[model samples]
Each structure stands twice: as structure tokens, then as C-alpha cells.
Target: MGIRHIDVRLCNGCNICVEDCPLDVLRLDEATKKAYIAYLRDCQSCFLCQSECPQDAIRCVAVHERRMPKAW
Candidate 1:
């Protein structure tokens, strides 16, 4: 679990989530002008995108549910 949801209805194409994401986990759709999770696996559960969203459209799962990397 990482980014759980993005409410497109509330989104205003502000691109805050896309710009504030430290891991580049989110992206803005050129056509729809909405933010979406482009790299779910890369999400670090930092909640930066969620907190920075002015529309409050971003939601993320807790860190305990985040995916763990496997050892090589």
C-alpha cells in the first residue's frame, strides 16, 4: 500500500502533488490535468504529496502497509 487514492473531482490541476513528491511518485496527466500515481512502488509513505495538496485530493496508506524491497 502506498498512494491510496486521488480524488480527481476535487483536484484543480494545481500540480502541487506532482512537484512536492520527493520520490517522483506522482504525475500530472496532460490531457485530464489531474494528478495520479505514476510510480506507486516508489512511494516512501512520506505524506508530502498529501500534506502539500491544496485541494486535499491525495490520500496515502500508513507506513506500516508500505511495500518492502526484497534482498537480492
Candidate 2:
């Protein structure tokens, strides 16, 4: 699965995901102080960010079915 969405409501501006993302697919918004997808295509979908997030804000979708739609 690739990185899908981030629940901004659940995110508390914690940077764990940003700090742990090996692919650097996410970053913290300096203005909103929230995590947002940065380089989506670069996402490795390892779920390291989701698992490391303390607030469980990161969400991922299964890609096994048919690679994540390129349109996304």
C-alpha cells in the first residue's frame, strides 16, 4: 500500500512521521504545524510513518489489488 491520506484532525503536529519516513514522503507544514503529504510518488508505503505516528493520523491504502491509481 502507498501513503493515502493523513487525518489532520488526529495529527497533533508531531514530527515523528516526518523524522522516520525513510523515503521522505511527508513533511510538517510550517504554517499549519500539521503533517501533509510532500512527495507522494516517492512514498515507499512501508507504513513506518503510520506505525511511528503517536496519534495515528497517517492512513494508507492497499496497493496489492492494483497499484495505487496514478491519478492520485
Best by TM-score: 1
Write model 1 residue lDDT over 1-72, tens digit each, in one string: 468899999999999888888888888999999988888877888888888888898888876455467797
lDDT of 1 at 41: 76
Candidate 1 regions with alpha-carbon error over 4 angstroms: 64-72
Clashing pairs in 1: none
Tens-digit lDDT string for candidate 2 (1-72): 388999999999979998888888888999999999988888877888878889988888746424556775
lDDT of 2 at 60: 84
What lDDT, from 0 to 1, does candidate 2 have? 0.84
CA-lDDT, candidates in order: 0.85, 0.84
User: What are the C-alpha RMSDs, in order, of all predicted structures?
Assistant: 3.1, 5.1
Q: How many residue pairs clash in model 1?
A: 0
